[model samples]
Target: MEEQPLISYQHVNVSLQGQEILSDVNLELRKGEFVYLIGKVGSGKSTLLKTIYGEVEIDAGEAWVLGNAMRTLKRKDFPTLRRKLGIVFQDFQLLTDRTVHENLKFVLKATGWKNRTEIERRIEEVLQQVGMENKGYKMPNELSGGEQQRIVIARAILNKPEIILADEPTGNLDVETGRRIVELLQDICRQGSAILMTTHNLNLLSEYSGKVYKCEHHRLTETTNS
Candidate 1:
């Protein structure tokens, strides 16, 4: 049997502040897949990512993510829909005031993970997955750019989300470090969750194995050979 897409956007249109960002954007991401959105700044890559998690409302066409209709989601339903998504931001948004452990713990608590033991275990698991198993004690300031991004990835997976929406996850690091971050994300994709990452770095497209879509002229089109 064929698997259903975790995210599907059919001719989806999105606008911000009365400006069109993405128009007629048809996209799909499935389980255990890594898809990349490549575009220059203001090309709707980030906006498309936002549409997946409900930050930007879909203006027209059919849009669904993790089984929630993007166009019809209620305000109260946003949190529940978001819980099924893991988001990695361009700026490593770790709380500087907290230890790495506390940062992960905060997300769990916010998402309603009440069991203390399970929270700790899940934290360790995701940290290990991102190669930061031993940095749980360090504060965000103590780690390098790459290490901090790793922690962000760790935090994103705390809920075992079915989809990960990453907005320029490597935009801050060096080329080498950025490659490493993408590699970590790919590993996570292999393990199960589908990842949709937005980036302007076209170099990554050649090295990564995944679907590639480019946003240009208010439209999103698949540009990858795969």
Candidate 2:
């Protein structure tokens, strides 16, 4: 039998402040897959991601993430759910006041990691994974755009999440840098984590060639290119 998808959204509807943003949405993400969500700004791309991570509540329909029914997901259980998923933001939301090592350490601690040896080992591992192993001592403000984003990706993988939700991760970088970032994400996907990324960059879609979905008309739909 085939395994169930890591994320499954069936006829899902999401709203904000009594205004519906996405309606009748159906989507799925399986392990070792890289999927892209593309649309113009305000077309609900980010909101769709928000629903998966529990930032936005499901206004209607059914949604399941990492085997938990979204509507039934309780407030107290959010931390558990979030721990299984990694989130990357466009702004590379690292603490400006801390070094890369400290930033990663903070996440590990916040997520319940207590062993200093284990935490240090994991931090080194993720930093090496993102090719920033030697720069752990650098502050966020000291790194270039691409470098900062790499650290952000490193931070995302600290817990070895089942799925990663990246919201325009490359939005602040140049084209070449963005391509590299996407490539890194693809590499991570190959290592068995599912990725659901939102972006406006259509060029990356063709270059990377993964499953593509467009969020428009307040709906989400899969697409193919010849």
Candidate 3:
């Protein structure tokens, strides 16, 4: 039998403060697949991602992520579900007061990693994966925007999540840097993690082929052309 999708949603309605943002949304993400969510600002791209991560509650329809039913997901179950997923933000939300090593270490510790040696080993591995192994001692301010974003990506994969939700991860970088980031994400996907990324950069779509979904008019639709 075929495996179930890592994420699946059908007729999902999402709202905030009594205002509906997304309606009748249907989508799926499978392992090792790379998917893109493209739309104008405030078109509900981020909100859609929020629902998958359980930040935004699903008002109607079926939504499942990593085998958890999001529509009936409880608040206490959020931490367990989140541990199985990774999230990368556009702004590079690294702790400003900590070194790259400490930042990664913090996540490992918070996620129930008890062994000091294991934590160090995992931190080194993720940094190396993102090509930031040597910069772990540096502060967040010491790195360029691209470097900082790399660290952010590294942080996302620390727990070896089943899926990654990246919200415009390349939004603040130059063309070349953004391309590099996308390449890195593709590499991660190939290693068996599904990725659902939101972006306004259409150029990257042409460079890297994948499933594309457009969010517009409070609706989601698959697109053949970027």
Candidate 3, 1-226: lDDT as tens digits: 9999999999999999999999999999998999999999999999999998888899999999999999888899999999999999999889999999999999999999999999999999999999998999999999999999999999999999999999999999999999999999999999989999999999999999889999999999999755
lDDT to native, each model: 0.89, 0.93, 0.94
Give the TM-score of each candidate.
0.96, 0.98, 0.99
Model 1: per-residue Cα lDDT over 130-224, one tens digit each: 88999999999999999999999998998999989899999999999999999988988888988889888888888888888888899888886
Cα lDDT of model 2 by residue, 1-226, tens digit:
9999999999999999999899999999998889999999999999999888899999889899999999999999999999889899999889999999999999999999999999999999999999998999999998999999999899899999999999999999999999999999999999988999999999998899789899989999998831
> Candidate 2: where is the Cα deviation over 4 Å?
none
lDDT of 2 at 40: 99
Quick one: RMSD of model 2?
A: 0.9
Candidate with the larger TM-score of 1 and 3: 3
lDDT of 3 at 188: 96
Candidates 1 and 2 compared: the better one by lDDT is 2
Which candidate number maximizes lDDT? 3
